[model samples]
Target chain A: MGEKIMVKGTEAIGEAAIRAGCKVYFGYPITPQSELTEYMSRRMPQEGRVFLQAESEVATVNMMYGASSVGVRVMTSTSSPGFSLMQEGISYMANARLPAVFVDVVRGGPGLGDIQPSQGDYFQVVKGGGHGDYRLPVYSPSSLQEAVELTIHAFDVADKYRTPVVIFADGMLGQMMEPVEFPDPVDPSTLPSKDDWALTGARGRKARYVTSFDIDPYKLEQMNLVLQETYKKIEAEEKKWEEFMTDDAEIIFVAHGTVGRIVKSTVKMAREKGIKAGLFRPISLYPFPYERLAELAEKVDIVMTVEMSAGQMLEDVKLAVMGRAETPFYGRLAGVIPTPAEILEAMMKEIRR
Target chain B: MSEQVKDAILLASMPKALNGKEFTYCPGCHHGIVHRLVAELIDEFGLREKTLLVAPVGCSVFAYEFFDVDGTVAPHGRALAVATGMKRAKPEMFVLTYQGDGDLAAIGTAETIHAANRGERVTTVFINNAVYGMTGGQMAPTTLLGMKTTTSPYGRDPKREGYPIHMMEIMRALPGVAYAERVKVSRPQDVPKAKMAIKKAFYAQLLDVGFGIVEVLSTCPTNWGMDPVEASRWLEENMVKEFPLGVYVDKVTEVMKEKGVK
Candidate 1:
């Protein structure tokens, strides 16, 4: 463990990326996440790395695609609208099987929604926002320390799977500050070699090219099948979640990210009121802890989902519960962050029903 | 007779930087000529083993297959932005982008302009063929004022569609641009000049200066509805008059002089 330092969430993510051997960062300024870009602009030069403020999110994501193709670690941070603009480039990088990382500090929006924090981008990030058959390994961290840890882990996951990894944070997380103890900086030289597939000038080897295109439908289908296999492997190996006091609980609350930590409070409130409550928080949104959630649903009479959006993750909770438990949802829409008391009251209503 | 046959010498052949595969371009399309020039320059610079080409989303989309160097295909109009990332990440490697008029001047205008403005140390070969050949002769941004095409069948009207965009003129205005030139291969006499401009553009990167671009006024005979010879003549007469051929910016020589080299 390294020395503990107080840091903002976006800046901590930037420092974590630098420590994780990220060599290049291309980004465009958007609210709530611009500090990460600003942080990189200062830190990358000091580290003898590349940091460029792209003309737009469209350009920024393509730049990531370019840098990643060269077998170097690259990343970018953006808010919801910028993330929306990056979808096309993400699809390209995903199909090309290039490894890269992105941090979407989600802000409110159907379109230019306020800069307030929101979990509105759950479907956009976990479900394929980009046009294609692809899945990104998305990590939702509940605290600043978890945010720092996940940012570093996302890079390794991206390289291991040869696909894009996303750190699904939000506006509140971006603004909040907390003391974080970072792991030691990774020595880039000691990292796994990508020379076999990386575009390293093709010297002393047969010329190589990377592309996601195949003019023939049969060949394209084969490529998609390979992608599907990768996703299946990831789903099998990467499901992660945290269960708090669920060993003997009758009601379990499902949540993730900032709302997840808040629901921990809700769990405490419910337990004090003698309702036997617990919390289940998903860390990996794509390879969701479905199997465990289903098992927990069998033990609990009610599974309640709380979110900062209009219950987008509720659909997944329902799918996991599959009517084994009475699944109810409580959500605050349009960038509203619900308090623990509100969530506890909502849980009580479901219990009474 | 055997001694005479054995003594025969080879004068000219294909460039080694180019893979021996035949091009898919239609007869009289200038993409073949431009590809040869680019490959020859890579060979001349001895950069074959240290080059990365960003292939565009046009007729030259398969340029990666043609060039015997490491490369990848960028989505339509994002080649320069992609190349910017490549060059920045690996400054030691020579990066280049090959884009057509539609891909560069239309869909990728922002990427092209901003890349130049940022002075990214990458080379760009822009092919201004006045029409989108791959998509069956749709009117491109560089299409002539009165030119007829699949989309502009009634001849381009300045009222409905804007005038032809002069990308070289745009490049000249950018402070980050190190070299910007407009050339052509319409006439046999113009081929060497086109190659020279391309070489200068490549030198802008090789010399560690700034952004470099050479807009080659090319022809698409099939799309232009003319025979090969007629199309060449038409490009020379019409496109040349609209987009004047010359060096729009030349910071390469100044930088070379500053480095105390010829």
Candidate 2:
């Protein structure tokens, strides 16, 4: 750890992106994540970078398409509704194979819901938020420091795979402050050039073109196949999760992001009560660590899922468990965050059955 | 044929800014004409190496393959927004957006208005063909009143389909706009004037002035259900009535006059 400083999750992400060498940021202001945009606006231009407040969420994502096509590191942050509006651009960028980072500080959704923290966008983010056959490598962080680390790592993974990466954080994380050690700033000038496909001016070379329109069906199919192969490589190499005391537990709880942090506390409380409980947290949600969860599910008597949404990620947990154990979900819907005590009670109730 | 080719001398060949590929435009389409004019202007200004074209998702979606300069295709109606990002990030690169009527005046109206209002150092070539050619002749926002289209089979009614949008007039009113012109490519005489208007727009960006736009009255012969020759005549007779030609804004010239330069 370097010099420790306290920052909100949003601020931590903004600083991390700068450290990760993001030179361009285009975003529209929204609740929960506005601080990230605000910080970028104030600091990016002063550092001789581009920070533009787009006219709308739609325009903001399209701007990323343009910036990334020029081989520049770029990022954007938004809440739920704004994230929804960006789905079309996300699909386009995915098809065009442009790399950029997007952070969704999730709030209660299904409409113009409350601006409070929620995990409702799990299905949308992990199961392809946009149209077509594509996936974004998603990261869900449990703390401010982890958000910073994962945010910095997101840029690397996105650039490596040439795919968009989404940081699936919640409003609670965005608003809460915690002590974090900042990483060393990356020299943007030292980054590798993307001349292989970037839309830099074609002076003495063949013109570089970036587009998703394939009029021929066979060619489109081949393009989709290429994307799928890349995704398969990512899944084979990048499935990450953390298992806490799951080796000797009879009952396990699966969760992620802010809810996972709460479940960790619940596991400690349940252990003191002589309940053999452990927590399984998935750090990468899209290429989820299902194999580890499946192994634990076979050993445990029950696998309980906890979340801030009604029960979106519960389906994934159940799918991983594969009928090896009793899979039950307990959640607080529409921005209601459950306490550790409430989660313990639900776990006890489910284990009793 | 070889003797005739030799006698022609190839004095004025295709502009090098254009890739050596045959156009995919339909017969009598004005996109071909506008593409040639823009390519010649890019060649004339020696911007072939520093230009980036953002083509729209209409009939020009494949324009990246047609231009020998670096280019990308924007989503439907988002050409200006993408161009804004490119220009702002790489100020040394001259960025341009090529869009049609539906893209500029309808679905992308917000992007078009906001980019010009911000005085982004970019140029936009608006091809107002008055119909959606790619989607098979739907009524466009720039379609003249009483014009027949697939969506307006009974002829467009002003109360129902709305009046033709004058992009040049609208863009000229923005203070950040340095130049705005409405030109046509219906006749051989119009081609030179159209090329001049396009070159002026490109110059606005090269000089780092405000945003510039050139609205070209184009034709969609197949969509208009007319032959190539008849479509040209129809545009000269009808389309010109609602969208008149000439420069509507010339703030670059105004500044030059103020500075007593040219």
Best candidate, lDDT-wise? 1
lDDT of 1 at A241: 93
TM-score of chain B of 1: 0.95
TM-score versus the correct structure, for each prediction:
0.97, 0.97
User: What ranges in model 2 sit over 4 Å off?
Assistant: B1-11, B254-262
The sequence of per-residue lDDT tens digits that candidate 2 reaches over residues A1-353 is: 48999888888999999889998999998997899999999989878899999999999999899889888899999999999999999999999999999999999978999999999999888998888999999999999999999998899888888999999999999999999998888876767668888888997898878877788999999989989999999999888788887879999999999998999999999999999899999999989888989999989889999999888888989889999999888999889899999999998888777
Instruction: Kindly list the per-residue Cα lDDT of model 1 for residues A1-353, writing each as its tens digit.
Output: 88899999999999999999999999999998999999999999999999999999999999999999999999999999999999999999999999999999988888999999999999999998989899999999999999999999999999998999999999899999999999999998888898988899878888998888888899999999999999999999998899999999999999999999999998898888888999999999998889999999999899999988988989999999999999888999778899999998888788778
Total backbone collisions, model 1: 0
DockQ scores of all models, one per candidate: 0.84, 0.78
Cα deviation at A106, candidate 2, in Å, is: 0.5
What are the runs in model 1 whose C-alpha is more than 4 Å off? B1-11, B257-262
TM-score of the B chain in each candidate versus the native B chain: 0.95, 0.93
Best by TM-score: 1
Model 2, B104-191: lDDT tens digits are 8999999999999898899999998899999999999988888889999999999887788888888877988888999998888898
Residues B193-257 of candidate 1: C-alpha lDDT, one tens digit per residue: 99899988898998988999999999999999999999999998899999999999998988777
Q: List the residue pairs that clash in candidate 2.
A: none
